[model samples]
Target chain A: MAVTTLEPTTGTVPTRRGPDSPRRRKVRRQAWLFMGLAHVLTLKQYLVGAFFAVLELLFLISLPQIVTNLANLVTLGEPALDVPVKERPNSLFMLVDGVITIALILLFVAVYYVSVRSALTQERAWPPDEPTPPRRRLRDTITGAAFPVLGLAPTVVLLIFFVVVPLVFSTLVAFTNYSAPDHIPPAKTIDWVGLDTFVYMFGGSATWTAALARVFTWTIVWALAATVTCYFGGMLIAVLLTENRFRVTPLLRAIFILPYAIPSVVSLLYWQNALNGAFGTVNRTLLALGLIDSPIPWLSDAWLAKFTVVTINLWAGFPYFMLLIIGTMTSISKDVLEAAEVDGASKVSRFRHIVLPLVMYQTAPLMILSFAHNLNNFGAIFFLTGGDPAVADTTTTGAGGTDIMVSWIYKLTITLLKYNQASVLAVMIFVVLAPFAIFQFQRTKSYREGEL
Target chain B: MSDVVVRRINTAAVAIIFTVVAIAVLWPVVHLVSAAFTPGRSMANMPVIPFSNGFTTEHFEYLFTQTDYLRWFGNTLIVATATCLGTLLFASLGAYVFSRFRFTFKRPLLMGMLILQVFPSFVGMVAIYVLLYRIGGLDTLWGLVLFYIAGNMPFMIWLVKSYVDGIPRSLDEAARIDGASNLRTYAQIIVPVARPILTFLAVTSFTAPWMDFILPKLILRSPERQTLALGLFSFVTDKNNFFTTFAAGGLLVAVPFVIFFIATQKSLIASLAGGAVKE
Candidate 1:
């Protein structure tokens, strides 16, 4: 790891010297001078560095002037303009500040340049006679290995700025009195207020509490109902399509996947119209068959609205589940099922014992992810009902009986402009889902281990 | 001989059950199309008879005449096309680098991308809105496209990277031996090999902007810039023209995508399934 030297004017000489040698002192002096000039050449490299240095200098020289101006502006108002603009800070003082700022900036630039160039120069100066050391090779390997990190810098920076910073800012907002039409920054003059929003949500304020409870209940019910109904319904379709006796299995499979391929919004709007009580196709067909006397209030009544939304979600979601299950089912070894069949297992028994367990085991992780997705299902509920059957209460903002936590948060931010509360809700959602995320991470690790 | 007969019976029963289920599954879509064309007492009073008393192209006419339906369609096409092109370019390049290069922080970077999918993008809504507003992207199609790309990048990068990873490194090595640089190797070798996944990505990416409503609603303030999904919302909400015209518009939106999906279904399914298994 010794530094290599270029040919010297005196001779082909090694620059390695004892610590107290005069040659060492002369070499260090030359290195410092080279570093200083290199720093001057790379001014742009230290622009950000220079900016801070200048800011510090300005603060020191201009603090008194700024305070005096602020006092005049506050006290004299219009009269302050009649006074002559104060003389610029003393010239000698300004010069000193500027020089000091420049010096610091130049120093920073010099240090950065010398370090980089020396590293590069030393790397190039390795003697032709000696082999590169193992330790050096290992260091190079480690450094080169960080290429992916360099590649991911933009995405990581974006995630921090857009996702992490906003999340943290919103979480902080939740603990403050930041509310509609007057969201002030929490500066030194302002005091922090904590947990008032949460208290209001859960306290004896009947409107908020009732809306909270209702939305929470519906969110859980919707998630479970949508996930389970889709799971079973999809499994059934998958089983039917894959059955050896089915003549038109491929066509059936294609048709089943149609709902999934169409985007969820399209499906929701299409179904919303199809389910309209007054002129919808479903009611017409039902009445044509004499199934009911009057059209059902599918989107107007609370329970019916919730049920319709869930059913639409199930319709939209199941096809993907069906696809996943079918894939899983096909991957099962045919010989295992053939063996069971030869043993005289009934069709139901074979499905229950052989098909179901295998598919379930393989698709368990996907099913869990689906559950999380359903819990945060926003598009279906928003486009279909817009969380309709609006609760009669006004104080609860714009949330309806069908609102999930996500939709409720939307209502808070967009419709009501209760951003502080929305932030609180967003944080709460993250908190609620954190455990599942951790579980998923752990599962991925173990899965990797198992594969190894 | 008796067991053979029983097996035949079971087969017949399974076929019958499948047929019944298929009918149930398909009935609604058939009803939707038929209702779209049915002319008599709206959809609510249609008879079981196959032929209606009258048939008309009146709904389609109304959709074009009375609403900004065509304009919305055009807007959506532009947005979806731009989004697809942008996403494919950036995501493919990023995915290629990650797949081909031995770089530091690769593992952490991949994990970070995966973790992003767990949190919905709406969590950053306020910040994005303010940032876009300050930067003058608010109320513009470009703003919508930016959000769309950002929202979809994590999944797209993972997908493209997985497909790229499946391609043999020897291809790159061969190209390099032929004196092609890294960029040339990617363009001349890797991309051509990854065409199937690229097509899948394109279709999915294009379809996303066409289907999206929330982001456009948030960002695009002017009616002139409203996309098809938002435009369809107007038709659905308008009490007078909600029924027939809404059906017509829905049919219009669904048909193109249905055809596209049918054409590319095999490749799409293969790419997705392959990615999942490899991941």
Candidate 2:
């Protein structure tokens, strides 16, 4: 779409000055300089020129400092005893400053590009006999450009500082020694330790490597199981409701969607309590029914807690998929199914060949997204079990049997202040998840059609 | 006769599965209501049946009288409302530009937003925490609101852009021809036409912060500033026997939330389906 919208003009301009004229070449070269068009610019045009000039001046001024910041980022900081304490080397500060500087430079380059493009446009539009007045030129550019500039500026700036900057800072944290009680800022300085954290986590120690292996494997399993179970569970419920002609179908559908309707945090927490080993309602009712003499360790056991969270996730997750599949099912034309049935396909085969393929085509991307979401489904495990009923490696690694990569990252950074390790895991999650994101994007209509 | 027999069997099978699944799904909800109304301080004493112990408003009463329930509700309301309004403002603005204008990096920027959503925001939470500390946003409600607004930007922009893309340019062009400024045309024309999707965005964004736990837990550490999720979570975890009270508080939020969700489920799903795929 942008290609269509931003195509360069190929039409010839009727120039009073000849094609090889010196004047035309001069104007073309002048378009690259700030205030170069001042001879032809009116008062309003001068103001526009002044605005871009100020931006250019700011960009020039910040260039050296940005370069210095980049240099300091590589060195982090040296504990210069000659400097005051406040001016002393803080690696965190340097890294943050470096990231900010890069964001600023990107912004400045965008502005520079816009200004130059506007200047060229102004030059091209100049008349052969009588040029457009400066006031009119100013109005034209403002109308053409100002709307997007004003509209996008706030969101763009916020994303740069908040989302992009922090991501860069975290990515950089993996290469540092910013852990607490030794390398914390303002008292102790952190130094760059390239790939050491990664090496340590993967093969550094027996406990850590084992913990990483367990959590990573479980993360993949949880993502796969959660996505598949929810998808099929919803499909079953949706098919059952749709295929059956029951008087109570609407009521059942309404009741089934309760988990989806209620906030997930509330539901997960309530389930945690209901499954309590000693005092939970599930155990209490089971005891009253004489099913078991002792309470079951629902959230206390390592393996059961994993099963409990996944099953409970089924209850919490299925309704959304049910609704989505039902939506997709409604779009399946009756003619297609009827044709399949008439071709001697039994009911099951008709569903398998016709309805299943149709529905899968529409909902598969969502299923993949669901897998990605489950990979970091912190609240599902955190609130339910707090990754508790700790396994052998939990004490050393701060990871319980149910802890996924994101939750483990939380435990490391928030509870243990292991910034270096947390960031390494964060980077690993990014690596593992990026392929799924790219795959989804490639399947999107925008990419396939080469239009947005 | 065989057809009738097969239909009967099918109906019987459907009924059996429905009963089992329905109980499995609805038991927790039923138990939550029971726990909230049962006359007890401890969940251990309560029976399984609803109203078996006789109904009492004591837990709800205790929630209001003893805990910071009202304060937490107010804080949550404030934060959710602000996040909704803020998301609406920035996302709609950014979306309008994306839909209407042809600019450099437009495609790359959109792609960047998609990629950003892939990287979990919590991974950078340490940097976020430190950033907030530097800005004096730690332990403040506004800081949480700002963070939520920033987090909602990428997806909401794409969603709202899909909606805005459908509006006929003629309407805005007509307004522009009548000497309306771009802002005026957007405010007076484009926004009203895009109301359905915007309303969907507003409702979803509002609901997000209401039950969000982790971000509020990390950012807001004060007793009085806790959101509903944080406050209710503390009820069971703290050194108190307030399981019933936790139930009471949970329902207070859940009941209204469920009602709102059900009321808007049709449009929400419709808009999501509309916005997700670009045909």
Candidate 3:
């Protein structure tokens, strides 16, 4: 404990006699390391914290230098890895990955600096102020951080490694020319073609530009159609089942929730089979009913496929709204309804005027959320249509009739192996959907108030 | 007399509408069960009543004996259990910190978490893949759990923190006065009171991976390491597919979930509403 707080006792040998000692003078100088902050811990805590900080610094140092050199390669065109390839590997991914790793390391250093700086603050008062010493004990001055650091260690580690690093890496990949053919690593070196991919995606290639316009339009349409149909359909079913004076309404509600209760993957596959172009259960039933002279192309023909996926999406999704509506309805105040009744409102009018708005009011945030959710509803699109009923114009671009932004990204990445394009598309998704998400969450007012 | 007649007609109309809607909603579930029990029933010749033919358990037998389903089931169980346990532990601890402690970075940290959750995590799939591959965790269940538990931490923290805040600090004070440390106080006093929320978290965490397809499909490579969703999906993906066997596998996957849903239906709906549509 270097900055030990010496009690200046008047009767005790003038503790000032030792004030001129070198160690004492050094302590006095270091005591004001934290000028304004209160020293909140004891000397034991300071040692424990210092020990942990050193351990953390060592851990960070071990992993960062290798990535830093790789990042340097990105900023300057050169190879950093040990492997001597016959052909040099692309450095774009290396660059992105390296920058992410270094940034994470730098972030840790900042945190450590803050921790130590705060720990070194001199105590405003300690030991009831026995004629306060010029310097404090090293052990006691290192206060306030030990227990909190120990508690927060696991969560912070996870955030840094799993969340922060990956986000940065993904963001960096968006800036390079990472698409197919020439940019792949281990075969050919990737050079930074800053904003070229963005240019092509936005306004360069006629095919690319046309595809984005078309797919983006369809994405908006699908989100709106899917969300509205499900919401209204759910509201109708919930209203009927709950309001109707039927003994079996409870049983019917349970049965209706089956679609929601089943695994979405299974339900989606089942719908796909039921809508298959050639021998679907839906076609067989239609033929049996003579509703059509010939089987309709439910999952083929670009237009029909759009309708089919949306309808099937509604089929899989309505139960969620139904469940939500029912929960809200059950909790609705009967007094309001009775008051409306006294105002001469009939049943239908009561539903139209009183009940609908209340449910909508309560569920509006969720409805907007579902719209945003539908924007990236990969399961419904992927399992049901696989983004099929391909459009001839955008086939090379990989945007199909049923493709939402998310499934389109999946196609670009996995099937086409154009990760740079996929990362760009992912960023596009965030750009488009994140604001709406934040807006809807804000509209809820609960999150804003620190309610949860 | 006229009012009575109108009321009767209204009830009848509602009954008819509800019954039709229920039947339509139940069609897929009914078909799934029917297909599972009928041996080799393809989509081409599926009867209106899928179970019109005699029932057979051959599809299930094929699943167990001819496929690595038991292994998939084991893998899913391990992953789900680990995820639930890991999420419960991490979320509770993080929530406690936010609820009880005041620090400079608390608000910003919470806000960052909320913003982070707004973007889907799959956007970072390639990045995560590279990280995991370098760290030797790419193809393992533990890797999947680490991803999921970390992914789920923010929302769960927000949820459990709100619940913790509702718990009075006086209880903690009382425990501290009784010679208890913070850890002891949290363990004995607060944790017991937060059981409902914790159980809600466990159920959701367990069920999420059970229904999920994207991450499992992206990460796992070998057939032996497949989850139920991946294994069942393989049935229809290949040439000369077995739709019946796929249905059988799907049915098996859904059975436990359906039972759990029915048992906890009320709590599930309440939690869903509270978590999603907060007021």
**Predictions: Cα RMSD each:** 9.6, 3.5, 6.2
lDDT of 2 by residue, B1-279 (tens): 698999899889989999999999888998888889998876786787767888999999899999999999999999999999999998987887787777667887888887877766767877887777767898999989988888889888877886787788778777867977667777899899988878988988999898788888888987989999988888878376678898899999999978876776666556545543443
lDDT of every predicted structure (CA atoms): 0.64, 0.80, 0.72
Residue A309 accuracy (lDDT) in model 1 = 87
Better of 1 and 3 by lDDT: 3
lDDT of 1 by residue, A294-332 (tens): 999898788889988877777787777777777777667
lDDT tens digits, residues A120-223, model 3?
Answer: 42222223244443344443232322334445557766766677666666666777766688666666566667787888789888887888788888888999
Q: What is the lDDT of candidate 3?
A: 0.72
Over all chains combined, what TM-score does candidate 2 have?
A: 0.91
In model 2, how large is the Cα lDDT of residue A279? 86
Winning candidate number (DockQ): 2
Q: Give the TM-score of candidate 3.
A: 0.88
Candidates sorted on TM-score, descending: 2, 3, 1
How many collisions per candidate?
7, 0, 11
Determine which window of 10 residues in candidate 2 chain A has minimal summed lDDT.
Answer: A1-10
Candidate 3 global Cα RMSD: 6.2
What does the lDDT read for residue A72 in candidate 1? Answer: 36
DockQ of 2: 0.50
Q: Candidate 1 has what TM-score?
A: 0.76
Better of 1 and 3 by DockQ: 3
lDDT of 3 by residue, B95-183 (tens): 77667764435556776676676666776765777777767777889888888888887778878887887788788777767866556
